[model samples]
Target: MEPVSLIVLLAMGTLAGAINAAVGSGSLLTLPVLLALGIPPGVAVRTNTIGILFSTFGSVYGYRREIAEEKGNLGPLMAVTAVCATAGALLLLASPGAALDVIVPILIVFALVMVIFQKRITAAIRAGAERRAARRGGAGSPATDGTDPSAAVSPGDDLSSAASIASAPTPARSPYRSPALIGTMGAASIYGGYFTAAQGILYLGVLGTFTGRSMKAVNSVKNLMSLIVNLAAASVYLVAHFVLRVEIVWLATAAIAVGALVGGYFGAHLAKKMPEWLLRGIIVVVALFALVRQVL
Candidate 1:
């Protein structure tokens, strides 16, 4: 690639890292640049995975507080995600390249639909959680309300009344193992293997089951999860490149790592201040761009 092209790749990687940290679709930036620079599709996937690894690190560091609190549960989740991702990466290597052209577009389309339904899904989960909490109140647990049972109503009445009280918006909670987490990790591994843009959104949508955090908190976990999966994928890619000896296409992976580190930090910081809707809007726009680009 020309120096000019390399420069463009670096810029794109940096931006991708930042946006990825911010809203979860950094691949759209790097992949096009890779293809534009004349890298083969298979090689591009490997290098992009390498580059995002740094960004993942940066984002995780930036969100360390949130992660520290949730660290106890991360081991099992990361183990599952990493193993599944390794399998996905191996599958990518074994499959024929032309096969990806057919598969990738479908994955992109499915991800787009998933993005559209993200909110409704979250809302439904929140509602279901509220209902369960209400039922639990019948056991004489503290109602979400602060009032004491002895002060006013009977425990039975308080329990029933808890059902009538306005549902508190569920805060994003700490991470733990769950069926949702397992399924999401599996799905994300598949997505990571195929089309990786906005993979964070899909993971977060599922991780929502265990966490009731703000977007920033969720993003921290997202970065941590992405780091685990991308690193596992990168290991497979490294073996494919070295052991299988695919041609070296470009040298921007290290730079992507550096840029992503910086970008992820900022992305996490910005997510704290940015409204969820705006961040989400940015994500939808990027996802649409990725979908259109893949289709065209």
Candidate 2:
């Protein structure tokens, strides 16, 4: 590679890594650059996966505090994601690409919509949970002055009711670890392994909706999960290069990896300071751009 081309690849990789660490779909930025530089599509994708492994490592290091807080919740899901991602990578290695072309755009659109309405959806979920708890409490309480138990509580007593709810015994298992969440995560991981564009956005939507984690915490988990998926896929590509004699552009991979490392560290720190609205807005705009680009 010429010095000028190498510099351009590194610059693109840095920006891609930062975007990925902060939100996701950094491949949207880097892959096009690689193609423009005359790298073959398959080689570019595989090389990019290798580069992302480094970027994600930096992101994980930057988000270590948040990761530590959520480690217990992340353990099982990580295993599921890794295993499913490997499967997806195998599929990618064996199959032709046309099948997913249509599906990808639709999924991206859905992910964008989920991000946009996340707050409202979460609020509705909380309201439903509260209503259920109120009904359960009402059933056991004795009526006084012929008043309905649910309606009998005064506004001032709401705090006490909430306190009682808080003091209720916690379940041994978190609802976040339910089969549905696991299945959804596995599916997303598979998609990530096969086609990575906006995979982080999909992860954010899933984690935000199901885990009810704060955006920062969810993004932290997103980085880890994405790392696992890319790592697994990259491993497959590495094996293919060795065993099947597939070509890999080592210079491009090195450039991206080095740049991504720097960008990931800074992006993680930046995300920590970003306001929720701004983070959400970035996710929406980037996802939409990715979606349109993919369709075109």
Candidate 3:
């Protein structure tokens, strides 16, 4: 590659890494930049994945504390994600890109809509869950003073009740483990492996809606899951490159990877200070831009 093109790749990769750490979908920026610079589409996609791997590593390191705290909850999900992601990567290697071109825009729009109304959706789910709990309580015990059962616990029972709640079975323990949520996450991983653009948005929506965790926590998990998907897909790409003699732009990859590493470190710090709404807005705007670019 020419010096100018290398410089451009580095700059775009840096910006992409920062955006990815803050809100995700940074590939939307780097992939197009790579294509516009005259790289073959196949090589560009592989190189971008390799470059973004460094960004994800940096983001994970930045969020190490959060990730460690959530490791128990994330263990099963991560295993499932890795298996599904590898399947998606194999599908990508076998399928034609055009097959997903039409579907991807629709998926992006749906994710944007979900992000826009996430608060309302989450509120509704919470209300529904509470109502169910109330009903269950009413069925087993008659009301004594018209007080809420949750508030009627005796002082001696408080510790036990809290412990029971904490130790509930995984599925009933949290909305994050619901069947719907697990399915959504599985789908998101598959898509992430197959076509990485705007994947972070999908992950954010899934994690935000179901996990009942703060954005920082969700972002930490997102970074880990994305790292798994990229690693799996990159492995497939490497094998195919050797078997099919696919070209890879090593110089371009090195430039972008170095930039991504720097940007991701700073971006993780930025995420700690970013407001939720600001991050959501940025995700929606960038996803729309990518959708439009794909369509036109």
Best by TM-score: 1
lDDT of 3: 0.73
* lDDT by residue for model 3 (66-105), tens: 8887777676677778887888877767766565455545
RMSD of each: 7.7, 7.5, 6.3
Worst 10 residues of 2 by lDDT: 96-105
As for candidate 3, its clashing pairs are none
Off by over 4 Å in 1: 112-175, 270-296
lDDT of 2 by residue, 139-253 (tens): 7566633556556456777777877875799867764576767888999899888766567767876776666666566888889898999999999989999999877888989
Higher-scoring candidate on TM-score, 2 or 3: 3
Sort order, lDDT high to low: 2, 3, 1
Q: How many backbone collisions does model 1 have?
A: 6
Instruction: Note the Cα lDDT for every prediction shown.
Output: 0.69, 0.74, 0.73
Which prediction has more favorable TM-score, 1 or 3?
Answer: 1
TM-score of each: 0.73, 0.71, 0.71
What lDDT score goes with residue 4 in model 3?
A: 91
Roughly what TM-score does model 3 have, to 2 decimal places? Answer: 0.71
When sorted by TM-score, best at the front, the candidate numbers are 1, 3, 2
